[model samples]
Target: MTPIRHNGSGSGSDNDHVLDAVRDCVLAVGVRRTTLADVARRAGVSRMTLYRRWPDLRSLVGDLMTREWIDVATRAMAEPAPGTATRTRIVDGLVAGVGAFRAHPLFRKIVDVDPELLLPYVLDRRGASQEALLALLADALREGHADGSVRPGHTERQARVLLLTVQSFALSLRTMTDEDDPELDSAALLGELRTLLERTLTP
Candidate 1:
């Protein structure tokens, strides 16, 4: 069990392999059954190699999900369509974010395979990924404010609220008990999200 003091070196590909192994293992045998030994075996690395970075299963999975979603969120926020208004850009960013969560393999596997492993992250304070999302949204909100498309309010606060709201519904859309007359399908919900963002941020 040799511990590598520096984690930022060749650890890059090794870490990716470990997380990829984690993703595959979760998708196959589920989170409860997955283990460092299993991930190491699947990753073709030693258990100590993983221990050098993540001490346990939960932290490994956290890193895996954070990696998966951060890439998706980056894509959704970075590339705004031509001629999109600032408000509309935020709307599309949020909506794209929801779509990213729904479509992500790790996300679906967690909900379908072992949801209990996900509850802690949802019920508690924001994790690294969630906080990162809030920051990204906050930056977008600030941009919108500069363009006079966003309403006068605390940018960071509004971004946090929006991130929490979107993550709450996005993560649990399948099981959330809404009292609205007729349930809104995913498409309709995105449409409503668009409308809500438009109204909330517009002058």
Candidate 2:
């Protein structure tokens, strides 16, 4: 296939399309195998255009992963169903967020083949993505506390700890054997988390 041509325009809609195209390619081919050429072909843009937006495959994949995580966090924190308990909502949202990480094949494969791929972003605990997620979780928790839904004292510290705890659960899921029932464990763990948070924040 001929390489795609570059359009050189950095419009918001254009960037969204590029990101969307990259997402599809990563999902289809996995991150390691998905080349700039592949993304261009799927996006219908020139390889030059993709390169213009993201100079290398690593940068493109990184951005794609970041965008995906942000989306997951947003969806997980969205309003829970009517009549749902606030504690349940928080636990379910966290469970869903962790599930997304465990299920994303591209991320799973990368971490499996080269565990260090996640080191700087997750294990390192100080990466930009981690910081962003921490802030997001803190904001979510603070809002809940303000509304009398979440537990109260030391919102910042507690939110950071909660996010780290969630990360630990996600990492453990990746190592679990096939015989281990992830669904059951996820439910039990989430229940425990909710109970802990309730006790910590209860008025």
Candidate 3:
């Protein structure tokens, strides 16, 4: 997904304020509760200005999720790492993505009340995040296969399976016991994930 270059009116400060307000509102009230009027009031921007820029709540939320949150995940995936260690990168990326999602209250609320909200995004029809993440993993897997460092076959299908695994792990977090440590669970899950990938990619 192309990073959104927010070329808002006036100055960078105003743009930053708007973004901050949107994020704050979403985190506080969730995606369903947040309104353009509320955002305009919170940001101290006129309703006309907010409307002119975002047009609708869905557009604003989509832009915020795509431009801000997903970009962070994409950059994390793009960082210089042991690309040859296919299992390590993919598991680490998935674990980190789950951690990031948990930290976002908006996501937590949606996933808690109605996970269906994520289907459109996860199914890759609503936004670019899913497609970008899938492509990233698929490309990484393909590269590993090409170099003979990782076994090859059904790279795209494997990527999708890994994606589903990550989602399942995240959704299962809520059912964990109080004794469970999220970090430890994440590490264990990722390790198992690496083992699975190893089996798949290592003939």
Candidate 4:
């Protein structure tokens, strides 16, 4: 991610403060209703200060989503059980990431309030966050190959397919969920996802 700038200097904490303000604004009124002025006010910074970093609300919100999503993915990838095989680690991390993203407030707001914002990333092109995630998945797959756990293949290709499968689960699982039917509920479907990944990656 590009470093966020403020007052002729760049700082991570400063960037987070700005994104936090953006998050609050979007959560309250959503993307269409949110304004740079409101974000500036909430961030306790001048509007020009925000403009220097982000020309418009869309770019700012894009960066905020990148940060939030990457954080979720990072946390998910970090928590596999001790001594887990590389393929198991990758599958577990991805499954956990699907759940985390589904539960994230910012993701929920965007899906509920401005779902079209996601259409470009889904149909047209990969966004920064998606690229980051692909890189992470590819690296883990390389490790799986080294350990003889994942099937042998082009790492990037394998990672892309893995991401495609996980994205379906993350984005569309809710539509398939049956709350009243334990046999086809979210948790049960996720178990199926776990099994699918295990089979896909096994050497």
Candidate 5:
């Protein structure tokens, strides 16, 4: 279920421009309406340049998601705070990953504009972003398990479950009925999510 990331060109600038174009186009007119020509126009690049990087819109979007999520996971792991317990680190990392998905503008745009576009990545195959996230989780879960701070299940399986939970809430919150929505404050949301994660890792 691992999805490959489509590396842009030799220059980081091309990737940035192309990804920026895709994000701008999606925000402006949704994924379905976004085209290579439009992306090129927005990026001030020729269609040839865009094609050289991505065969189509789907490929571009996949890589864009990967880059963004990699940034999210990288940032989360960078600061572990002194003396953080392994299980606590797992919870914190999960919450941080969820926050990234929640706070990302492009993610929000996709959720609001074309939610269906997110289904494949969620239900079927694990794309580059999913793999990146899972790897990060796996590393943390292994550390937790080794220290006897986490549950006894396979680290990869536990990571997958945590990832699914995070993705579900991050992507499907809009589907909640008005009365069903918790409407909790930020602290409450993460606190509840952390509790749920903690129970699975504890006796």
Candidate 6:
């Protein structure tokens, strides 16, 4: 996902207001039904204002997703117990991130109503958000290696593999879950994910 260039003049708060409108519109009618006019109206800005910032609805939505997902990952990574080992922090952050994404309203909305929008990122190529996440994971892995907590390897490759594993669980966990069976429920599966990640990163 290329970063959405804001060629227009606006404060950060102004941009946030527009994004808030977009989010509300998406939550109400999804991506297909949303229009520039709708966003402009809801945001109390002209369509030209939005046009200057984003070329199309897809680009706007892409930026929105990037903002949302990064925030989720950042929050998760920041909240681990103090003085935790690098490996433990990495594993706990990822598990918490998976859970956060699974429970996020916007994420649930996109998955339920605009899942096809995600297919390109999943199947064809990496997006900006995915690249950002990979960078974060790679950095953490490097720190883990320095601390003798993670196995020695190519940090980038290890990060990519960790991402692939967590991505699968985040996107597909619901499909495999059995609400009636506690052993197969989401929490149970997430625990398994935590264990898998810890083992993978541990020396």
lDDT of 2 by residue, 118-176 (tens): 66655443544566677877776776776677777687787778777777777775354
Estimate TM-scores for all models: 0.86, 0.74, 0.70, 0.93, 0.84, 0.93
Model 2 weakest lDDT span, ten residues long: 1-10
Model 2 segments more than 4 A misplaced: 1-9, 80-88, 112-115, 176-186
User: Worst 10-residue stretch by lDDT in candidate 3?
Assistant: 1-10
Q: Give the alpha carbon lDDT tens digit for every residue of 39-116 in model 5.
A: 989999899888887878888887777777788767766455567768887777777877776788877887778777
- The Cα RMSD of model 1 versus the native structure comes to 4.6
| Candidate 5 wrong stretches, greater than 4 Å | 1-3, 177-189
Candidate number with the higher TM-score (3 or 5): 5
Task: Choose 2 or 6, whichever is better by TM-score.
Answer: 6
**Candidate 6 Cα deviation (angstroms), residue 11:** 4.0
**lDDT at 133 for candidate 2?**
75
Badly placed stretches (over 4 Å) of model 6 are: 1-10, 79-82
Error of 5 at 139 (Å): 0.9
Q: Note each model's CA RMSD in angstroms.
A: 4.6, 5.8, 4.6, 2.8, 2.8, 2.0
Q: Write the per-residue lDDT of candidate 3 for residues 1-203, one digit (tens) a residue.
A: 21223334556567668878888888777777888889999999888997766657766666566656565566556454554365556555666776676666666766665466566644555255556667777887786776675666798887878767766655565565333766556566556655665666674
- lDDT, candidate 1, residue 119? 70
| Candidate 1: clashing residue pairs, number | 0
Off-target runs (Cα >4 Å) in candidate 1 are 1-10, 78-82, 176-183
> Candidate 4: which stretches are off by over 4 Å?
1-9, 79-82
Residue-pair clash count for candidate 6: 2
- Local distance difference test values of all predictions, in order: 0.76, 0.67, 0.65, 0.88, 0.77, 0.87
Residue 34 alpha-carbon offset, candidate 5, angstroms: 1.8
> Candidate 3: misplaced stretches above 4 Å?
1-17, 81-87, 112-116, 122-126, 176-187
